[model samples]
Target: MNEVLIITGACGVGKTATARVWAKAKQGVAIETDYFTEWIYDDSLERFTREEEKLVANLSLVTAKEYLAQKMPVAIEGVWSPYGLSLLHSGLKKKAKNAKLKFVWLYCEISENHRRDELRVSENQMKQRVDIVSQQLQSYHWENYVHHIDTTYLTLPETLAAIESK
Candidate 1:
C-alpha cells in the first residue's frame, strides 16, 4: 500500500510550496495537476481547453494508481474540489488496500488587496476570478475528510515543520 497526500487549495495559496516541502521531507514524488495538463497540451501558458481539463483529470487518476502500485508516497497538489476528491477516491478504491489518503487544505485568509498582490494578477483578471472565488469560497469547505492548515501568516519553513509534525 502507498501513502498519498492530496494538497488542495485555491490558486496562489501556497500549494506548490507545500508540495515542494512535503516531497522533500518524505522523499516522495510531487505531482502538480497543472503540469499534467501542460504536458498534454504542450502549452503551459494558454488557458486550458475543455479537452485538456478532462485529460488532466483522467491523467491525475492514472498517476495516483501508478504511484500506489510503486508503493511510493505521492503528493498531489491542485485546486481539486470535493467532486474531484470523490473521483480520486473512486479511482483508487479498487487498486489500493487500506489506502492511506490524507487531504491538506491550505487555508490562507488573505485580504483582497494582499491576495491580488501575492497572486500578481492584472486588475481585470483579479476582478473576474477574485469576485467569483470570494462569493463562492470554493476552497473553504471540504467533504469532512480534509485536514485544515491555516496558512494566513506562516513562513515556508514553519509551514513545512507543521506538516512534518503531522
Candidate 2:
C-alpha cells in the first residue's frame, strides 16, 4: 500500500511544524496545501470561482499522485475541511493502486484569544482567513471521521510524536 499522511488543524496550531518533523523523520516529502492557492493566485483581487477552487484542489491531488508514484511516503499539511479531505481521499484511492494511503487529522483546539496572539500571520491576514473559514464551516460536517489527535495542550514535538505512534 502507498503511504499518505495528512496533517491538519486550525490556524496557529503548529500543524506545519509537526508535519515537517514527521516528514523528515519518515523520509517523506512535505507538501503544504496552502501554497497551492498562494502560488496560483497572484492577486487576491482576482477572486477564485468555485470551479477554480475545485480545479486547484484537483491539481493538488494530481501532485500528490505524482509523489505517490515515486513510492515515497508523502505528508500533506494544512487547514483542510471534510470536503477537501474527501476530494483528496478519493484522489489517492484512485491513484494509489498498490500503495497504502493513511489519513491522520490533527484536531487542534485553539482558544480564540490564543489564536489571536500566537498566530504567525499578520492580524489582517488571520482575520481574512478565519472569516472565510468561518463561512465555510457553516455547511461542513466535521464529525464524520473518527481518527483525530486533539492538540489543545500538546507542544509541537508532542503532537508529532503522537501522530507518529499510529
Candidate 3:
C-alpha cells in the first residue's frame, strides 16, 4: 500500500532534513511546503504570510494526492498545526482509500530549538519571530494520528530510527 507521511513541527525541529532523508531512503517524493511558498511568492521566507502559507499547504496536499494516486509514497515537511494535519489526513483518505497516513511531530526543548535556529541561515528572521515560534509550541495539540518524537539530544540517524520504530 502507498503511504503519506506528514512530518510537522516547529521551525527548527529538523523536519525538512528528516523528511528528505526518509523519502530518499524509501524512494518516495519529499514535498517541502517552503518550496511552494518560494515558487508562488517569488520572495524570501521572511516575506511569507498566513495566506501564502495556507496556499503552500494546500498545494502540498495536492502534490501528495497526485503521488498517492500513482501508488507512490510521499513525505511532506512543514510547520503544520493539528488542524492543518487533520485536513491533509482527511483529504488523503478521500483521495486514496488504501493509502496509509502517518503524522510525525518532531520536537525539542526550547533551548535546543533556539540553538538550532541560531545556526540556521535564516537565523535573523527566526530570531525576530521567536514569539511566533513560542506560540506554535504552545498551540500544538496531540491526537491519535500523531506520533511525537523528542529530538533534543538525538542524532539524525537515531531520530530516523525512532521514527521508523514508531
* lDDT, each prediction: 0.65, 0.64, 0.77
The alpha-carbon deviation from the true structure for residue 157 of candidate 1, after best TM-score superposition, in angstroms, is 3.4
The full ranking of all candidates by lDDT, starting with the best, is 3, 1, 2
Per-candidate clashes, comma-separated: 0, 4, 0
Which tens-of-lDDT digit does each residue in 41-115 have in candidate 3?
322324345576666667887898888777778999877767667777777778767887788999888788888
TM-score of each: 0.72, 0.74, 0.83
Better of 1 and 2 by TM-score: 2
Which residue pairs in model 1 clash with each other?
none
Across residues 68-137, which tens digit of lDDT does each residue of candidate 2 receive?
Answer: 7787677787666666677777777777766566566655433542574355655325544544543453
lDDT tens readout by residue for model 1, 99-129: 7777777766647324634556463233344
Candidate 3 residue-pair clash tally: 0
Error of 2 at 104 (Å): 3.1
- Predicted structure 1, TM vs. truth: 0.72
List candidate 1 segments past 4 Å from native.
Answer: 37-55, 112-131, 139-141, 164-166
